[model samples]
Target: MSADQWIAFAAAIVGGALRVGTPFLFVSLGECLTEKSGRINLGLEGVLVLSAMAAFGGAYWSGSAWVGVLAGALAGALLAALHGVLCSLPRVNDVATGIALMLLGTGLAFYLGKPLIQPQAPQLPSIALADWSSNAAVRAALQVNVLVPIGLMLALALWWGFARTRAGLLVRLAGDSADATRALGYSVAGIRIAATTAGGAIAGLGGASLTLFYPGSWNEGISSGQGLIAVALVIFARWSPLRCMGAALLFGGAGAVGPALQSIGIAWGYHLFNTVPYVLTLLILVLTCRPGKVAVGSPGELSSTRS
Candidate 1:
């Protein structure tokens, strides 16, 4: 490739990374928080869809992007709370409940989002970092939005709190042994509930980002399984918040492959380029999901074990 061609490709990748990684950042963080509390919500995929629908509907009805974002977050938190309640019941499994929530989230999103299939919703504000650049290549490389930095900051906060704070220590303990946490007078269910709720909120924001920001619109078909893949990204990042950011961006870059290639006039045969993210997900899962590996980093009571 010529120098200009290389610059163009690099610029496209940067832009694509920002666009695609937004959802991943939120979902991965949610999953991280949830996992840290000894539960896993596989229904984040549902959360994404439902949040997208809610954000669009909220924006369409209220004419404010912020309202839509808030509505989406509430919806996601409610879903997560439901999962928390179900999983907390005696003999009820977290994984099973998460799967059910997945179904519920998807069904509700489809039912309500059906009406928003074509309506235009208000757009959320984003940074046009590219505007600061003089050269076209530089401009293309700098179109990242505020979410990128916010997500990064959140990751840093999570990492610091996880390693340093007493509250973080308790969360880690709750995951390692609910009985131990209970022995210390901590409410096991409460910890899990809080984690799941927080996770839902984050995931909801991710969903809102898809509709209110990136695509700046919504439909039943928006947010194509980014939530599910984010579950895998958690594993890829080894549960580290900073690593989660890296993984999110990596997945985003992979997701951008199809569009970036098409823009450069190279149509990947049969649209195979779109499969990059999934293919990467599968590869990461197979590589990391060894016997007993899940139990290693995973919380002690969480239901995402290999068995």
Candidate 2:
């Protein structure tokens, strides 16, 4: 390839990382938070879809992208709150409830979002970091979205909070031992519910990023298994917010490979390249999810012995 092609390919990957990684960043963080609280939300896929629909609809109706983002967050929180509430009941399995919620969220989004298929919604604002660049490709590559910094700040804040805050310690305690938490007079249910709901709200931002920013439209297939993939990302990150951020970027870059290759006129294996993220997910799981070995930093409640 020529120098210009190489530059374009590199720029495409950079741009794709920024654009595609945002959703992964948010979802992974959400999952990390939920897992830290000892509850797994498999329904984040649903949260992503429902919230995406809600965000798009909210932005479309209110004519404000910010409103759409909030709508998405609220939708995710509400759905996740339902999961938390149900799981609090005796004999209700968190995993089963989460799966059911995923279906429910998806159905609700599809039914409600049917009207949203054709309308154009307002898009979020972006920062043109590459405006000073002489190359058009470079300029396009560096047009970072506003949410990227927000995601970064969120990851840093979560890492700090988990390590430094009293509330963080309590959450870790709850995840490690429900009996210990209850013995201390803290309601495990309450902590978990709040954590799950908060995680959902954060994940909802990822949905908003999808509809209000990247594709700038609502569609049933918009999520494309990102929510599911984020579960693995959490495991891959071992529940570290900082690691979650890094994993998200890695997955984002993996996702960008296909498009970058296509941009450089290597389209023969475009579809194959798109499978990189999924392949990476499987590999990570195989490497980390070994038998008889708990992943480092996994919450005690989620450990094989407890589970």
Candidate 3:
């Protein structure tokens, strides 16, 4: 490729990192938060799909993109809360309950989103960062969605909150030792429920990004398992909110490889390149899941820690 082509390709990857990474950032952070409280919500895939549909449908009906985002958050929060409540019951398995919720959320989304598949909804606005560039491709590649900044702020806020806030201490205490937290007069179930719901709402924002920003549509295949991959991302980040952002960008860049290469007239291996993110996920899991290797900074009471 020529210098100009290379520049365009580089710009595409950078922009893709910002664009594709937004949802990953949100979902990973959400998972990080939940894991911090010693709970897991494996059903974020369902949350992603359902929230995407809800966001799109809400935007279509309300004529406001923000409203769509709200709908997505609410949908995710409701599903997550249900998961939390179910898990609170005696002898309930968090993983099993999450799987059931995933199926339920996905089925409900498909059924309700049928009409949304054919219509256009209001889309989130973008910031044109490459407007000064004469190259059209560069300009196009640099148009970033507004959600990126919000996600970044959220990551920073969460990291700070975890380190400095009393509420954060409470969550850490609950996750580290439920018996101790209970002895201290805190309700372990309540804390976990709140954390899970909040995480769901955050992940729901990721769903909004999928439908209201990039790809800009609601469909059955819109999520493509980004939600599930985010669980692995949280593990990779060792449940650190800030690290989650960095890891998300890495995955986002991997995901962008295919499209970036295609922009430079290289399409022969497009499908193979598109698999980079998934491949990376597998590699990360393999590397991280070693015998006797405890994740640095992992919550003590996390189920994985016990396992």
lDDT of 2 by residue, 185-263 (tens): 9999999999999999999999999999897799999998999999999998889999998899899999999988887
User: TM-scores of all models?
Assistant: 0.93, 0.98, 0.98
Could you tell me the lDDT of residue 306 within candidate 1?
A: 25
Q: State which candidate, 1 or 2, has the greater TM-score.
A: 2
The C-alpha RMSD of each candidate to the native structure, in angstroms, is 2.1, 1.1, 1.2
The prediction achieving the highest lDDT against the true structure is: 2
lDDT of 3 by residue, 1-307 (tens): 7889999999999999888888999999888888898888899999989999999999999999999999999999999899888888888888888899999999999999999999999999999999889999999999999988899999999999889999888888888898999999999999999999999999999999999999999889999899999999999998899899899999999999999999889889999988999999999999887788777787888744331
- Each model's lDDT comes to 0.84, 0.92, 0.91
True lDDT of residue 252, candidate 2 = 92
Ranking of models by lDDT: 2, 3, 1
Model 3: residue 195 alpha-carbon error in angstroms: 0.3
Q: What is the lDDT of residue 295 in candidate 2?
A: 90
Give lDDT: candidate 3, residue 16.
92
Candidate 1's residue-wise lDDT over 113-183, tens digit each? Answer: 88788889988876776675566864755566656677788889989999999988988898888879999
